[model samples]
Target: MLQNLSSPSLQPSSASPSPFTHHSSQNYSHAKPWPLQKRPLTRLSCASSGPKRKMVPQSEKLEAEQLVRSIMWNMNGKEPVLKTLNKYVRVVRTEHCFLLFEELGKNDKWLQCLEVFRWMQKQRWYVADNGVYSKLISVMGKKGQIRMAMWLFSEMRNSGCRPDTSVYNALITAHLHSQDKAKALGKALGYFEKMKGIEWCKPNTVTYNILLRAFAQARNVEQVDALFKDLHESIVSPDIYTYNGLMDAYGKNGMIREMESVLSRMKSNQCKPDIITFNLLIDSYGKKQEFDKMEQVFKSLLRSKEKPTLATFNSMIINYGKARLREKAENIFQKMKNMGYTPSFITCESLIMMYGLCDCVSRARDIFDGMVQSGKEMKVSTLNAMLDVYCMNGLPMEADMLFKSAKGLGIVPNSSTYKLLYKAYTKANMKELLQNLLEHMDRDGIVPNKRFFLEALGAFQSLPAGMETATATTVVGSPLGRSKT
Candidate 1:
């Protein structure tokens, strides 16, 4: 047995507070200031009018993105963009300016993109890089700005940034974007041959993909086969993207056997079919009205781990609708909803058009109404779908009503909308509505071109002789009617 140590002598002194109590009641007022340390000296100028900007530690990439966004937001025109950029070119890093140039290029502002490129060239810190030129060339090509893209290639060479496979690929793609397909293909092939001769500029997988896609789109089967053979022989292994590109091009051209062969080859290569591969197969089969094949692919997609995307459902719905399988289309739509996939504008538009085509105008209207009630942004296509349904169902009055309320719905009717409405009004002999539409077109600066006249004449030609005379009599008094008479 041990005696309890409760002696007074073992207790803390009352005059001195315990260590914990002392810390808890710290005397901040009497605390000594930390000793000042000498900071590294930076050069200062008294001549500066404003206080120097504090160097905030941030990622160069993030800063670059912010600078680009700032310029874009303040951009009024090319001149303004140049002026604004001039102020920042010195302050921002070189890599940031490159990003800015890419952003402008992506927006289809090719002239502004060129200005930035030229501005970058003039900068003291600017070093020629293949990436910058390749990106610019790709963008210019997408917009069919072939001349600018070619000039950029020349500029890149002059800047000592030797053109690589990527640069050549972009050049080939730009040429393919031109309206003269045959000429463009010839130029692309010329570049391909040129690329093959140079060891440093040897064509890569992207190079092969670009050429194969262009040739396939042109429906040049001989060229596609030759390119495919060349790709196989090349050291660079073709990826899924390469096969997908060829498959899409072939599918669009109605080469079902060729597309399937590509799929089989993809499987043999041990390249697992991704979502895009299945989507293309489904869409192609649907277009061909080969429902069994389409269903087989859909089931295969489901069996695999690859999740069905919005595109997958859209293709299924569109195809089912095309085949007049209304119940099947609706079932797919319901399934899409159950899978927690939100309906997009394209989805709504497809359903509306499908229902309208199947002579279910009420169901189409219901879908359109649901979209509106759900606060979804109604696109011009959605409006067109509903208007088309009304027109197709011989309900021109309803179509006219929707057209009149287009402004309220934030829809700026394009020529297609006008054409649909005109056809309906003309057929129904709604002279008042037709005249109003012509006036609206004039007001909107939508010139009634030859296409409009030809379509209107064709519509009238389909009517009985008596009805045609009545329509002419109704139109003759109106402004456009007088010109026609």
Candidate 2:
């Protein structure tokens, strides 16, 4: 059992609140009170210390096992929960260990599940049964452990367990996800052919869905067409998952025409689009900067009775704000409020950027300042955004001051910050200051790129009379470079 490490008490360094110190007051102009704290989640059992026990009662073990099962179920079948359960299983010694392993594998905890499987093999009660090996192989394949999964599938047959279509589909999915996808797909096709030859185990719609989704995600549009043709020839009908996977793949890959074609195909097949279908289309449209199309999809989502999740609003806010359509962005921000959706850090960041880009520097600063006051932790990205706003509004002095305060608070400036400083220094035409910053950038691993050096050279060329004459570095040979002509 891992002991919980207590958080150390660290004090803030200065008497005066650093300008970089977080302000927690949220912008109530458009957004409602977005609660920052969520209900405390049940800590992973492995991360928490267990009670000391000596020969625990069967009833006690049963109660603890039930609690573990509850945790596993509530986590929506995640791998972290399985890892925690496996650790707890060792401590409690439960008979339902295999069930835990199965659930673990379903959650993609293949390595931890394998640990339990190997442990089972060492036990006297271990039986090389078909169901056991099939489950193990299916789990391994789902996790992309194709070689191990295939070996287990063969071993199952050797141990007298019959091969099934379900087992074959799992292996196919695993093979498709493998790094050597072409090789895996070839092997899958061979297995499919062998299944047909045997006549005992036949490929089903599920197997075809797996193959379709694999081709879709791989962006092998040619292979997708071929697979569809083969499926039609075999009379294996495609399902909603098949279409949804293809839509998502096309949307993600920025193939708008391909995505629309798939949607048209789905409609022709009499398949009604779902919320996921609408969401993916909207997301893809937004990514393409096709705001008009994105809005159309969003409206369709509402008409379909699918209550927009936080994700839906977040996408709109960011996309609109990025396009500098502040009015539309603010309207969505207000709508999110009316819907009882509180603005997150991401929302605030979008607001800051939107305001900044629109030349509303003071408003952007107010949002940033209020965010800090509201106890929301300012991420480095947010800080950079504020810093950019300062520099852009001809306030490099203020930007430099903020940088100093940020550094004191241990917020290391990144390359973006250096770039901003280079721009600021050149605009100010402070040769000594620029040289000092160049040294600082080098120290911070922000090596000046060609563009940065060109900007610096341009600033030097544009320097005022006395500024250039007194500050210019001398070249050994040239008249002005050597001594004043």
Candidate 3:
């Protein structure tokens, strides 16, 4: 017979129910803790002095219940509640009230999440669970709070809750999301083995897939191949997710032949490709400019009776735009509308990019205007595409306007965006715009690439008054040099 996991000795037929699982739904009874007697809300920390805030009381269970209801009313999403709760939380100690904290943690409220975690520790009803700690760890990971995530993982163990496979997976994924790839990969591998060490908490297919993705992202092709061999050697079977990860990695690394072989292996394994699989293949072919192969994959996806998703159309349009295949890309856009799939932010971004690439500035502007009219949020890529199109067609003023619009809309321009605007000003010899954009990039912490440096050098060379060239290459073994912008 399968044993009840919560309690081993309590048999289903003959034994009394365990107390842990016996919390009655009707009896909401608890002796009030001393903290609940004073204020209804506890104030933990105060930052900007605007108004006095209250924390949910620790003692009054009913008060905590009402407070939760009020907090829930104030919260439309995690961000708002997190901001409000950060100033408040010290008074509330009820387990039910911890829902606010957990939600905040799940939603990337890193600091508030820690405050709640600490608050839970001080509460009498706080029974540490692997689930709670794992959640906190995942939140911290997502928010780039790696140190905090590790601390919570260790705290879970110290609190007598054993880390399970799920907890390890969370940790691995967190590290993987960090900006430092080498360190993240090393950390993920460490957790992978730690999960494997426990007899009951062995690494599963999901665990391997996460690691496989990490290795692939790091471009460790040798590790990817070894993982496949190890999977075949072990009892674990590779699934669709595994194949998709490998194909994506191979495609990204421009290893088209290896990607095809992996597709063949997927077929031999009888793992029917899903939408994501088809999207990967199409995107890969498109990136390689193998449009014929890309079209073939698109046709196969359509014929397979699996409906094409937004990602499918977005990939096609973006690749076609990049290749300057304007007509065919537009046809796909029309077909998507005909198929009843509404254009998303990505779809609009692709179309703007496509028209921009084809030098159809008016058409790109039309799409941008439509996006605004429909109240669709504009992405930085869309703004960048528009800016690039304007600059390419000798419309610097229009480019400047779009750049200002991006700033006004609170959209920070990336390196590519700044690069386009910089080139525009360079062509027109507009020193102010040119200097300003470089400063903007610096302010935004976006590192200018070789492309930016090269463009600036070209601008300096194109100066009318004098050429920035070496006056003499050899003069008594002293080579001449010129300064570039």
Candidate 4:
């Protein structure tokens, strides 16, 4: 059993909050937070005991990524990543361990993260550093392991690591990921208030960014306004990320007025709009189907000094495709190419989706075939996009035909492909097609779970009752099907 290493509940008063001392050594600025853009893999200058926190060379950084990738590639699905970490205990330093946190966090291997932390504690170089705890808290938080995150916070204080802005920020983020979001926000504000008092734990720009985005995501307009006001009054000046985060949250939530208001605030502050700023406006307007505004933003982006990124083009293409503006979507694609932008796999997929939405099946397939013939590595999503187009156009047999040849094309179908096909086949009332898909799923060792059935049955719900009953019986009796409990 993996040991339970969580100490007592966090008593912030018990630990003497140490003033952060910057490392004078040219190689390190260990006392500071790991830059958010870098995460665990970015660099190796975390504050820790002993002499290990130093500026690691690029080779060392690559070594960490390579080591994690190798472990992931070699795992037997059940062996603990900690088991692999054990073999590399000597080679794995603080930087390598940090990268491990990120990679494992991606896979939601939060327990393994704890196990790795426990292992790190036994090592001679181990120190109760805020960066390590902040990262652990972040990983657990992302995994929705709120209790675990809380434990790590307590453990950090117990280990004599003083809580800093980064650690508190991570904790606040972890709470926000919890199901009781209202409670989480309250706790986050509580912490934000607390941070103001503690000189060493004072809220920084990151702290404000986290809260601002959180409130915006919750559509708590009043709170967002208050936070923004508080931010402006504070010593910390908002950066591009500040406006971008606010705009993105509001844009995604369809709070157009709030989004535009934030953009205006960004302008009033004289923070020049970057590519991200333009892209967010385009996406927001496109989502609301306000094509005129989207195009206006696009035109402005063209006039700006900043170059449009792949996201800018991809958003335009997909949104145009969604609106069945095939010519416009095509024009955007042409413009991308004319401007020397090579189409990404996602770009190709967007074109496929666009063509399908516009009833241009032949055109979509033409692009797919061209991509395949060019020896571009076929991704499951790309294939799924093509299959989805066929299904959307009432071409079940065609989708099955392409799906059957997927392995031959060096593209393997995952559960998503199976789910897509099953839903489509069931809705079409094609028994043979559904059975064949089930067979393929079995061969791929994918057992259809309740969620899969629920989604497939959701498609069945709109059909005549007799047809729904008939298809459900077929599903339950199939070799690979398990009835929902």
Candidate 5:
């Protein structure tokens, strides 16, 4: 069990159960928090209008970044961050602290982010502001720490800081991150309604963006429609993120017509399609195996001002691979290379899976070999991609051989790797091989937990075996395996 992973990315309603979601990819970058947009959908910040922030010079920004990274390396036996902060107290500024939150938040160190916040408060220059509380709430929310976020909201008020639109937005988004979908949805709506009566905390586009995504993912079509109607009647206008999040939610739920309806509404509102919009369209069509429409969208993307990204290519390759459109997938890869797009480990994994589906196991092996010999550190998933090909293609022996040699390649196998192998070995009815794998699992200190035992009763739903694929915090361009926009 990957307990309480703070991915914070939205997904289709588990209730909808789309076949497309069984694709089984991991570590995608598109899982950033809601309103996953590069541009500010609107000036929706709850930060009271203040003097313009002077841009930190590039040199100062780089210096601050280096300082944050150094503190993070924990190079000493003791707490380097607190010690360094005391020694270099002069450098302790709002921007630097924000950078600290970012680095710490990535590693699930929300408590440390709070420590830094406390340290800031102790400074003579520190001032309590809605922005600080909002940032902290957002960080806690992303970590699935809803109670902490609520406490922070209360603490902000106790500190004489008024809750603002931005603060409410963070609180609502945090609620959505909670495990109980029904409770989370109800609580988010409660906050949404509460924000309405507060004069200064009135809802903004960002607020709507967050709520719309929540309801959309909950499959509450009526509520989604009601929200949009309210948006039209209000002074706040919908933006790219608003439409993008809704469409993405619908698309993931296999509500293609609703997704398209969003596109039409978007055009009617004069909100232009950006890269996310195009990628979402491509992914939706690809999953439905509507090749002509997918290709048309790709062509349109090429004609647009926004260029294609690695995600764009990765999604197409995996989708084509799933359909066994081997040549088209290869052509896309070639085009990606010709466009000077460098394939990442993700792209390589997609390629491996693609080739496997095309019955070109040897070709898949060549790619995996290049990845191994590239001398770059490899991911377990990349190796699993090759292993998946072998296991899936009825070559458990070859997969076993690769698994044994994984340590030599500096790749450490995790539970997923074991799960994949376990499924394959049992499927092949190789008793001796299963015993060998058990030895490896025991040696590695991995327990074959109860659920894993349950899994033994069914064939491992290897990724796609069948079908198919974003990076970037804002998820600008590529759309294969992203969080619902």
Candidate 6:
């Protein structure tokens, strides 16, 4: 028989005695022969009561998240993550184990999730249930581990757990994560067709939502239309997520007219648009460079009860920057700050690039410097932005200086860094600097491919005839000649 690891017998006993326990032998007959004075009973009055402490209950999800974080941080012993997990598993409730598996799955620790699931199966409390298999399949599907998800389905059936609608839904989602998009869609359709014949496994709203969203993402208009037709024929009512998912997918693919049609359908169904719906519309319009439509959506969002998120401002700032509307981008950045949204790394990177593209190099430098002083971990993108700006503005000398300081600042130069510097040096016709860069590239193991040679030749061809031949031969030969046999 499987052991009950989390049983009360396995847990540690409490050290302290209960306060409610009575000492029966103690006498209290003459302890309080009180005075009969008529005093106002202040303690009994409602006004005299102290403020009640607000007890915010900890949810299972929060507890699971915390447990996963704790395990990840403290698993220092010479054992696998699963083994370390076993020690703690013996003390927590079964529900907590399920939650931990979910947390691990979300963090892409699929192997560890499998270990926990297997451990649960060995416990006496575990029974063959469709929910466990359904959830596990969903997790595996999310990580694109379709083979493992299929194996789980086979194992679930062997354990006498019959497949339900939720389980079928999980299987369809797993197929959607497959690398072959056409094959995945075909399998999903096959499952949908199979589900129709099984009375107990009739497709639910969730099933329809999944297939619709998948088809919309693939931009399979024909399949999306057919699915909608099937959905209308069914008794299941489509929820807000169903519409929202379709709209978001369509908007991402730049199908604005189709997205608007979905919005109209939503309104007709009496389903109110949520914050996500507005964010999607705003982002789509902005990406299409339709500023007027974007602004109209922004105004409508402001008027509606749904508050704007940081994503709302981020999308607007990035798109305006792309459109070269410097003033508008800056205005949106300022609006985000006024609304108490702290600038994230993405926010800083976007602003820096925007300012650089607009020839406002000084403003970009100020933002970079501010970020440095604030002690936030600088990302490579930030450094690359500054370097690109210097090169773009005919300040390669300044860019070289920045490159030298990068190592001291703990910022590592990537391939993009080398590419930018090489182009800059080649343009300036700094032969000695170009040679040094080649040596550095060789040391860093970044091999000069055909594309690199083509760019180098193009840059050299721009020079006078005599200089061009000599410089091109010298530059191309240096890296190849210096390479270790």
Alpha-carbon TM-score of each model against the true structure? 0.79, 0.56, 0.69, 0.85, 0.80, 0.71
Model 2: per-residue Cα lDDT over 342-453, one tens digit each:
7777677777777877778888889887977887556777788888878767777777777767765446788777777766666676555556665666566565555554
Clashing pairs in 4: none
The worst-scoring run of ten residues by lDDT in candidate 3 lies at 22-31
Which candidate wins on lDDT? Answer: 4
Instruction: Report the C-alpha lDDT of model 4 over 371-411, residue by residue, as the tens digit.
Output: 99999789999999999999999999999999999999999
- Per-residue lDDT of candidate 1, residues 344-382 (tens digit): 888888898889878899999999889878876678888
Worst 10 residues of 6 by lDDT: 27-36
lDDT of 6 by residue, 30-86 (tens): 111111122243422211001232342467447655766676665433467666767
* Candidate closest to the true structure, highest TM-score: 4
Rank the models by lDDT, top first.
Answer: 4, 5, 1, 6, 3, 2
Better of 4 and 5 by lDDT: 4
Tell how far residue 204 is off in model 3, in angstroms. 0.7
lDDT of 5 by residue, 210-281 (tens): 888778888898999999999999999997678778888887887888888887787666566666777777
Which TM-score value belongs to model 1?
Answer: 0.79
RMSD for each of the candidates: 19.0, 16.7, 13.5, 11.0, 12.0, 18.3
Global Cα lDDT for candidate 3: 0.66
Q: Where does candidate 5 have its weakest 10-residue lDDT segment?
A: 467-476
Across 1-485, the per-residue lDDT of candidate 3 in tens digits comes to: 01111122311122222111111111110111112222223433211111233554456556766776666556645545445554456655434434555556555657766765676666544555544565566677778888887887777777766666667777787787799898888888787777767875677676778777668767787887887887787668887667777788778888888788777777667666666677788889999999988888777666664567787888889889888899999899999999999988878877887888888889999988787677656678878877877887788888887787786765778877876676667667665565566556656766654555576566555555532332112111121112222
- Name the candidate, 2 or 4, with the larger lDDT value: 4
Q: Evaluate candidate 2 by giving its C-alpha RMSD to the native, one decimal.
A: 16.7
Q: Please identify model 3 stretches exceeding 4 Å from their true place.
A: 1-108, 178-180, 375-381, 392-394, 405-429, 435-485
- Cα lDDT of model 4 overall? 0.77
